[model samples]
Target: MRVTIVMAALAVLATAAFAQDSPSADNGKVVFDKWCTPCHGAVAPPEMPFGGDGLPGTSALGVKYRGELPAVLEERTDLAPEFIETVVRGGLFGMPITRKTEVSESELEDVIAYLTRNNN
Candidate 1:
């Protein structure tokens, strides 16, 4: 167990080092489309209240934010890098934790860049 923990820590450190490279928001959009769009996609006008029958994340956020914030992930501009990193890595409410294998540290960094591109 100790060895496993140490190995995991080292792997995280290594990935952190690799994530330092400049991330591309364009590439992040691709990753987001592939991985996050299914649950977090835009809701049509007809689906405004519930996000249709497929977009649970969007619908949930719609209910959670009550219009104070955009439910569509792409439209949100208040995301912070640290918050994104924590939520993506540890999950939040109904969102599942994304493993490094699923979205490598580099990919996560890129996603952050893409999501925060419109931030002030």
Candidate 2:
């Protein structure tokens, strides 16, 4: 009986440890710095607004969206997660493909968590 109880306690501890751990904003930040910052910069726009006028480069959607991402995403949550996943995987219009080939499915989930932040 004592051995069984000890095993049950170990199982409970293991479950708690695993449940408390999850990939979140910090992991998303690393992915963003590598994949996004070159295009979008650190903060979203209206705060740091700029178009290609200053720099002879990309069309900087940060400035284009102008803080509208939260609203748009909130309004359009009816679209399935797969749709967003496909868009992220393929890239859109002139944007380059966002994900490195090595990124796993779970990392994509982390990115989604970052995008649909609690602000909305």
Candidate 3:
């Protein structure tokens, strides 16, 4: 009985360690919603106080890809973690660069994990 109890405890500890090593999509979703959703969401209500603008990034991507790829980043399968990190940090065209203050390193990793969750 004591041996069995010791094995159970070890199993629990192992599971906890594995979980910490993995990136969380839920946390990534929160980061994406807070930062990228404003410009990249599929839809934005026109009733918003910020003038109800449509998704600029989505629109631009649609025009650029011409339906060959998904306009929404999350729906896209061709994205690489490196590309996402570069664009987020360096900005592209009309997009503004995200500073470390706005997005920490760990938060960026979460966002990358969230966006690339389907790649695997």
What is the overall TM-score of model 2 with all chains considered together? 0.53
lDDT of 2 at 56: 16
lDDT of 3: 0.87
Q: Candidate 1 — which residues are off by over 4 angstroms?
A: 1-20, 43-53
- Candidate 3 lDDT tens digits, 1-69: 999999999999999997887777789999999999988987755643543347888877877898999
**Pick by lDDT: 1 or 3, better one:** 1
The whole-model C-alpha lDDT of candidate 2 against the native structure comes to 0.54
What would the per-residue lDDT of candidate 1 be over residues 17-56, giving only the tens digit for each residue? 7666779899999999989998888854355453454688
Q: For candidate 2, which ten residues in a row score worst on lDDT?
A: 53-62
Better of 1 and 2 by lDDT: 1
| TM of each candidate vs. truth | 0.74, 0.53, 0.82
What would the per-residue lDDT of candidate 2 be over residues 32-94, giving only the tens digit for each residue? 556655554433333224334322112343245565542233232343556657877887766
RMSD (CA, Å), candidate 1 to true, equals 10.9
RMSD (Å) per prediction? 10.9, 5.7, 3.5
Task: Give the whole-model CA lDDT for all candidates, comma-separated.
Answer: 0.88, 0.54, 0.87
